[model samples]
Target: MPEFNEKAMHQFNQGLIKEFRENGGKAVSGPFVNAPLLLLTTTGAKSGKPFTTPLVYTKDGDRIVIIASKGGFPTNPAWFHNLKAHPTTTIELGKEKFQAKATITKDPERQRLFDAQAKVMPTFNDYQKATTRQIPVIVLERI
Candidate 1:
């Protein structure tokens, strides 16, 4: 199979964002909605501006986790940086919306959690091979 096209992938992300906004962020189901996931917005750490990104996530105890795989890109995603600068963020699940604090998990702990999640969605392993950067998973705890 051909490698995923970055340009095309970005276009798709843009489209997903547009559709998500117009529809109040009700994720288009199928396998993605199998586990409870939601859209989240993180304020740009450096710019101090907000950005919304739809994410596939799952709950780990009381925390909601989102992976910054960026389809396995070499660099960390912008949202990761935003959360790093400011741990506070917002999330929308189904018709409910609320705020949360982001906690960027590091080694050992991160690896264990990532592995657990990858079991639920194996594509995550493929995502790692597609990029040079180690994907960072952010755990959002309701505040």
Candidate 2:
């Protein structure tokens, strides 16, 4: 695998964020085009700063679910840690934005949600197989 470049990733994320906002939370082009996505804004765990990340999401009832796959990397994503420290967050879906509370799911529910998303995205299955740590499944409920 190629080495991870934090700066490059940040730049890419900045562009995606701009596109998502300008297009009403839709990615009209780029790798995430047409992919179900949402903007998750979480308070930084250590920085005490607000950080926004564009993530692919799935829905369960009235809640939104996101996986911290990090492309099956060894460690969880930073946003995951941020949510753990501060569960209250902001979610931008489609053309709407709202406050939400993040809940990390466990066991059967986690498995169920992960499987459901993998069926829709397929790549999640591969992401799971790539690492030993069980990926975290989080539910964001409107607040």
Candidate 3:
């Protein structure tokens, strides 16, 4: 596993968000190649601090969807933890931004949402096969 450097990761991700917003559709994280995504700005579940994570997304009407795969790691991503504590968040899509609510997909419904999203993000299937944990699909509705 890679060492976790909170500061470095924050700087790098913030740069990505700035670029994504400034460059319109021309700029995006490396993850965007296989899936449409947005930056989810959230508050920490424990520390109560703010953080942002780049997440693969799908659109359902006016809502944005994200999955907490952590590349199939055993643990959920920090962003997912944070969003659980603070379900309300911010979504940055290209040059736009909006308030949103982070809702974890539930039970049988999760299967459908997960399959639908996986169609757009085949890498998610790879993530699933890599770990035993259940990857969560977090749906963010515009608020």
Compute the lDDT of residue 108 as modeled in candidate 1: 90
Better of 1 and 2 by lDDT: 2
The estimated TM-scores of all candidates read 0.81, 0.96, 0.84
Residue 142 displacement (Å), model 2: 0.2
The alpha-carbon lDDT assigned to residue 48 of candidate 3 equals 86
Best by TM-score: 2
Task: Quote model 3's TM-score.
Answer: 0.84
> In model 2, where is the ten-residue run with the lowest total lDDT?
1-10
Look at candidate 2 and tell me the lDDT of residue 65. 94
Candidate 1 per-residue lDDT over residues 58-127, each given as its tens digit: 7789888889987776777788888888888999877678999989899897998889789888889999
lDDT of each: 0.79, 0.94, 0.77
* TM-score rank order: 2, 3, 1
Angstrom error at residue 50, model 2: 0.2
What is the lDDT, from 0 to 100, of the residue 61 in candidate 2? 98
The weakest ten consecutive residues by lDDT in model 3 span 25-34
